[model samples]
Target: MSLCEIVRLEGYIQSSYLAVYPDKIMLLDGCCRADVPMVLDYIKTTLKRPVTDLKVVVVTHMHPDHAGGAHKFREETGCLIVSADKKKQWYSGIGGRTMHFVDIHLGYYVARRQGRPLKNLYYSASL
Candidate 1:
């Protein structure tokens, strides 16, 4: 039996999870880019592991609060970045890129019009 340890990282307005499995580490919601240091420190100190040990960084969506640190995490950890779902079109090539851009920008525009910050809005689960 494998024990999975899940840690909820603090300080970020958006909640993020670090799930440590026996053989793999999966980060759910990369948090803001500004939270990178805190997240990395938590993984190293609390988990007693190096950043490179992370196997996957799953970004639930392209929202800044959820995926802002994904690029940095990938660059730093050399981990594979995967989407939360198996929908190929939703995360695959040109179409995926276009969709992400459209969704994020449209979300921002709507939030702005409503006098709310996008970061304060909770993104729906991809699944």
Candidate 2:
């Protein structure tokens, strides 16, 4: 049988799961944009693996803490982002863009409430 280990990496506002195998890795969630460096470091330092081993990133939702780092991950590791195929984009029009901005601030509020230090959480509304 093949062996795979799932490790939980604590992010600025949420936790992300990494499924590690001999030749591949998968992120269960996108995590916060502030967390990209931390997650990449963990994979390279702790897991002793190349960043390219990260093959897939599954975004559970459009929330800042859930999909914020997806584009960064793809840009860094060429990982495929998997999410629900919706008929309409969540952040489409001007109002939707405003909501996206509000959501990012809300993420910062949550991090502050959790006693976490402020970090850059800005991400493109269009995924």
Go through the candidates in order and give the clash count of each.
0, 0
CA displacement after TM-score superposition, residue 39 of candidate 2 (Å): 0.7
The stretch of ten residues in a row with the least summed lDDT in candidate 2 is: 1-10
TM-score of each: 0.64, 0.94
Cα displacement (angstroms), candidate 2, residue 79, comes to: 0.7
Task: Put down candidate 2 lDDT per residue, 1-127, tens digits, no spaces.
Answer: 2548889988888889998989999999899999999999999999888999999999988889999999999999999999999888789899899999999999989999999888998998977
Which candidate number would show the highest TM-score if scored against the true structure?
2
Q: What tens digits encode model 1's per-residue C-alpha lDDT throughout 4-117?
A: 888887634456888888776888876766567788887789888888878788877666567767777788888888875564534357776666666666656755675754
Which candidate number maximizes lDDT?
Answer: 2
